[model samples]
Target: MKKAIKILFVEDEEALGMVVSDSLRSRGFEIDYHTDGESALQATLTNKYDILVLDVMLPKMDGFSLAREYRKVNRNTPIIFLTARSQTEDVVEGFELGGNDYLKKPFSMEELIVRVKSLIGRLLYSEESQLEECFVGNYKFNIQKQTLELNGKIKTLTYREAQVLLMLFEKRNQVLERKLVLDQLWGDDSFFNARSMDVFITRLRKYLRDDSNIQIVNIRGIGYKLLI
Candidate 1:
């Protein structure tokens, strides 16, 4: 049997956290809930979680700072930012700090569950069984191990980054529409999400920079094409 999906959720509001935790537990997900960013960060560093759900405002540290620190040590774990602020700047900042998704306040438990489940489904189950290894120009990508090898150097990729790269590789030399990718990964193409996509595209470009022949070219107003 498959193991339960693990989640580390951080929220300052006691009532809300309890409700969300109870709801997720009812759905059979393993949860480690915290009320402050400092403790959350410590927990993340010591434990392995499939996904992170963090609130923006916390007692010791803010979500953005915690995410930045978390990425330094662990990039593979996916992160979702919870915030009452829906401003474009806040959303963009969250993504820039390596957030996978931004969820605004007053959200429905059902919506949050869907987002969490969707991320788990895509990040944990996508393409692991069928694709063992593939090539992107001169780089060897191992899907199961989630590593990129080139020139005797191996680098790890975050789950989202690997997913984006895989999608581009599958459509090599073909244009992948922006909205299609956004929907596939983020479940929506909102302005904030679109901006987040740009960040990931930039990251992919940097990752493939070693091979000049491999390029992810943007098709203005259309999408991106991976030219290999």
Candidate 2:
């Protein structure tokens, strides 16, 4: 049997959390649930999780702050934000902070399950053994090792960051849709996951900052383009 996808879920609503947790468990997901941002962040640091489902509004830390702190240490774990706030700015802010997908409150359990499956599928497909080393501008990326080397100096990449970069490299000069990216990485295309993808993109840009010839371009409503 395939390994279960590990998830860390941080939600303050106790009733909602139980329901979602139970639903996901029934579907064979390995889940860890928490009620506050601080404890969630701490648990994330110590545990190995494939994905994170976070709520924007939480006691003690809030989802955005928790994500920001998590990024400082773990730059690649995919995060999906679930919140009742539907404001455009709030949605934008969540992406800016590193959320991979977002789902508004009162969402259906079926939709959440579909999104999770999609994200996990993308991650699994992205790392298939058939894929070989790829070049991104001046640097060469060894996907298996999650390393990028330029001029003989090597830089290690977090697993999720490498996954995103590899996908962009595979579709270089083409529009990589936002939904496709989130679906592949976080298993859903919710608002929180969209924001999380943005954060990963920013980190990729920074990693390749020295190479002026390579660029990761945002195509507005579409997705991203890796210009080499």
Candidate 3:
């Protein structure tokens, strides 16, 4: 049998938390639920989980803050933000922070389950896995090794960096949405994760500085386009 997906669910609402937890458990997911951001953050730091479901408002630290802190230590675990705030700016902020997906209050459990399964599937098994190496601009990146080579010199990348670069390279010249990138790399697209991604992008820019023709341009609200 396939292993159950492990989830760290952080929500301040006790009733909703229990309901969601029980629902997910019934669907074969292994979930660890926390009612506050601090304990949730601690659990994430100490344990290994496949995904995170977070609430924006929480005691001690907000969901966005918790997600940011977690990114410092864990880079790839996917995060889904469940919030009652449904304004466009709020949604954008969530994406900016590095949240993979956002579900507003009164969301359907069935939709949540579907989104979780889809996100996990994409992260664990991407179409890019079919190719061993991808050429981005003038450099050749080995996906398995997570290294970028140009002119016989190889530069190793951090796990998150490699994942981001690989995704960009695969979708070169196309507009890669920020949320999609965040979801794929960090499991959530919230403000904190978005800032963390900016740092990673800066590092990547410096690494690819030698190639003048290649550029990774930010498309304002949309995402990034890897220009070759």
Candidate maximizing TM-score:
1
Give model 2's TM-score versus the native structure. Answer: 0.67
Q: Candidate 1, residues 116-223: lDDT per residue as tens digits?
A: 888777766664458888999999998766689999999887666777888898899999988988998877988878887887899889988999998899999999
Q: What lDDT score is found at residue 228 in candidate 1?
A: 92
Q: Model 2: runs farther than 4 Å from truth?
A: 1-4, 129-133, 140-165, 173-227
Output candidate 1 Cα RMSD.
2.9
TM-score against native, each model: 0.82, 0.67, 0.67
Q: Rank by TM-score, descending?
A: 1, 2, 3
Query: How many residue pairs clash in each candidate at the backbone level?
Result: 0, 16, 16
How much does candidate 3 score in TM-score?
Answer: 0.67
Backbone clash pairs for candidate 1 read: none
- Model 3 lDDT on a 0 to 1 scale: 0.81
- The sequence of per-residue lDDT tens digits that candidate 3 reaches over residues 34-105 is 999999888876789988999999999999899888866765566788988856666655644556677878
CA lDDT of each candidate? Answer: 0.86, 0.82, 0.81
Candidate 1 residues lying further than 4 Å off, grouped into runs, are: 1-4, 45-48, 72-74, 87-89, 96-98, 144-149, 152-156
Candidates 1 and 2, the one with greater TM-score: 1
